[model samples]
Target: MKKIKPLFLLLILNTISYAQGCSDAGICSVGNSFSNEIQESKNGIELGSIFGKGEADVISISSYITYTRNFSERFSLSGKVTYSQASGEFGTRGQFGDAYAIGNYKFKKMTNKQWSSLFGFKFPFSSANLKINGYPIPLDYQASLGTFDAIVGITFNYKKWDFNSALQLPIINNNKNSYFKEYSGTDDFPSTNLFERKPDVLFRSNYTLKTTNQKFTFRPNLLFIYHLGEDSYKNIFGNRERISGSEGLTINGNLITSYSINSKSSIELSLATPFVVRTIRPDGLTRSITAGFTYKRSF
Candidate 1:
């Protein structure tokens, strides 16, 4: 029994969701978000799934688990993992995504307002063997970027409203990708090459309204994402190819609700839709819905 324990734990970790990026699950940051109403929370866990549907019959399902620990009155740390599977007319794929560690600090406080800052790091700790029909998948479809990134942000809270802004930037290049390929004159060419990706900047805000009994609450949120630049691909011939229509802005709106089962647990549901798209996005998500259950225990 003891010898099997390590393998059993590894299997469980492999199945854990490694969710990343900003899809329909509100604004996904690198840490335990600082927008929670219960500021006194010492420990918490969140588990959820999100379903996304897009054009060309494309569909995505993602699962996630997050753990948070607060060591002091004004500081906290969080960790999360995700797994996802996506399918469309092209093909299907399932793999682990990314992992994150975040630290948050409350820097200022006032009568009805508070300010906080956050910084974190995301590790591309997943297997890079993701494929579709035995062929390498594109960056948009792959489960992991195979690179490390840094996350930084700030938050402002006033009354029942919370505003958050964050930046995600890749600090390293992925040179181990063997997926990029181009067609030659009459045959297909394959190469294990490097990939260059742009940074993502996001701004999100939400307003919450609760019932008198505080058992039911409703929240509406808006998220905006801006891609900084165009992504590049290096072919086997050492020539760089610019991927067109890859950089743009996306705006999404979400309607969220929560029902408290008790003080220690709650159930939440949400629906998100794209409000505005500034560029031609290929395989972009048009709508998504998410359901989550949360358990919180203060120590």
Candidate 2:
């Protein structure tokens, strides 16, 4: 349709505006418009897949299933579980990443503007200590971060624009990886043994466009993720050392297109790439480009 022209223009403009970002670790993907879709519906489910290339020439694939139930107009809850795999010349490793639960609440006092808050928790599957050929592989090859994380965010929507801010904080770290000791020097892996990650802060802005029929929707977003502190790792001597250059910011531009297949079903696609990056990304979250597909069903 003629309206599609603006969607492409928005995508181009979004990429140009950054001129410069993420490597995302599970923040921007949640709480779209504070999950208003799930809020409006009584119940829903989603299945999705995301394909990405990470550091050290590793390729990653993630599949997830989500279910949401609405308790009322002001509150809703959703739960998700994911399975992820990473493979490359180093080797292949696959496992469950984490289980996530998100709770969304809308503000009743905000009559003129839509404001919502989100809180969630991430439960890990196991210690991120996958081995290959008797040697420990780097974070890029592990499916899970091996940390229990707490996520809290707030969203604001006004007309055609949306804004969000969130934080992903590690509450408990059980990462037992020792890849650096075995592969850092010999295999040219980044030296991040026993990886301990810091919390991340996120800021996202987007503009949404829809066709007259509302069957088609396009959203272009710019996401910023900031590593809050210097990450630490255990060295050869068993002494903890700070990984300098680990604390920095990454910016990414993303575009999402969605189509409605009747009322209860829809398909969505998204593409994202970074414009700027930090010198180091030890959390195994770097992605040069990412593409994803998702299908949703409402009940």
Pick the lDDT winner: 2
Each prediction's whole-model lDDT (CA): 0.62, 0.78
Best by the TM-score measure: 2
After superposition, candidate 1 runs with Cα above 4 Å error: 1-32, 39-41, 127-129, 175-193, 278-299
Q: Which 10 consecutive residues of model 1 have the lowest summed lDDT?
A: 183-192
lDDT string for model 1 (1-299, tens) is 35434533433242232212254212353423775455466787887777655443456776778788888768888888877777865578777777778888886578889998888877765434466666665444556666677888998889989888888887875534545545322112223346666777888887777777988776667788887886666776779866676688877555566778787777776555555654533223233333333443433
Per-residue lDDT tens digits for candidate 2, residues 149-261, read 89999988776787899999999999998877353455445666778899999998888888889998988788888889889899888999998888988887788889999
User: Candidate 1 — what's its lDDT?
Assistant: 0.62
Structural similarity to truth (TM-score) of each candidate? 0.78, 0.90
The residue pairs found clashing in candidate 1 are: 17-81, 17-82, 17-83, 18-82, 18-83, 19-82
